[model samples]
Target: MTLPGLLSATVAEAIELVGDVRAVRRTLETLVDLGLGYLTLGEDTPALSGGEAQRLKLAGQMGRTQRDAVFVFDEPSVGLHPLDVRTLVHVLDRLVDNGATVLVIEHDLDLIANADWVIDMGPGGGAAGGRLVARGTPEQIAADDDSLTGGHLRRHLGG
Candidate 1:
């Protein structure tokens, strides 16, 4: 359903409306995975948190034929619980498995650690710096003593 179509129903209500259809039930499962089982589809779109919006978009892509596509996300882990973040990771993994290339601009350590490669920018944020401080696999970044990301990653990696 479109946003206007959903304006009167909670997601749970939408699921009930469909009555035992596998696809609708899977959507509720996706919402729960994203820590959004409590959402009313009637809620204003602009009121959603960043993580909520990102996950909603992901939900839309569910079961689609995806290949040769590039998906970009900015700070998708924001406002997500660690467990929810794990769910988000699985979604991204599925995208890759379906042959999409995913690029995420993020600062969350778990997300960063899970990346196959990383480009860490800055000696400082904004005008204070624009240099590429490091670029490597997460383990390589963690080994760079001068990178701030390295320090946090080191701790996260327990190294």
Candidate 2:
């Protein structure tokens, strides 16, 4: 198990006290939220994937008390498992809940479905598309017959 997962599994209820156990556990929870529970704490930074490193940076930002901050991520789910992507979505949700504006340029169906709003710009990528092909909640996007993204979303949503 990763250090954060191990620490969380052995919280104050099962572990001996050192100092500020709550703080330690809170930090571990943050790590888990960023999907770092699946990665070893002692792991080398160079060994981390783009997505993992982005999540690490995101976790650092979570410590700030700043509200109304804009957090933009470009394909942060690049190398994550779907389960880890779910965890990352939850972390993003928390940022939104805390009054942060979260914008994710993602292609993951799960992430798209969870978004409050989505603006899909493509009949095709670069040189072929720039006009908005679809814009709305995932449901609306899925219902759009002209959208390639909508077609995939329909299947992803099992509709």
**Highest-scoring model, TM-score:** 1
Give the range of the ten consecutive residues with the poorest summed lDDT in model 1: 1-10
Report the CA-based lDDT of candidate 2 relative to the real structure.
Answer: 0.80
Global local distance difference test of model 1: 0.84
lDDT of 2 by residue, 83-151 (tens): 988888888888998889988998999999999999999899889989899899999999999999999
**lDDT values, one for every candidate:** 0.84, 0.80
The TM-score values for the models, in the order shown, are: 0.85, 0.79
Best by lDDT: 1
What is the total number of backbone clashes in candidate 2?
Answer: 0
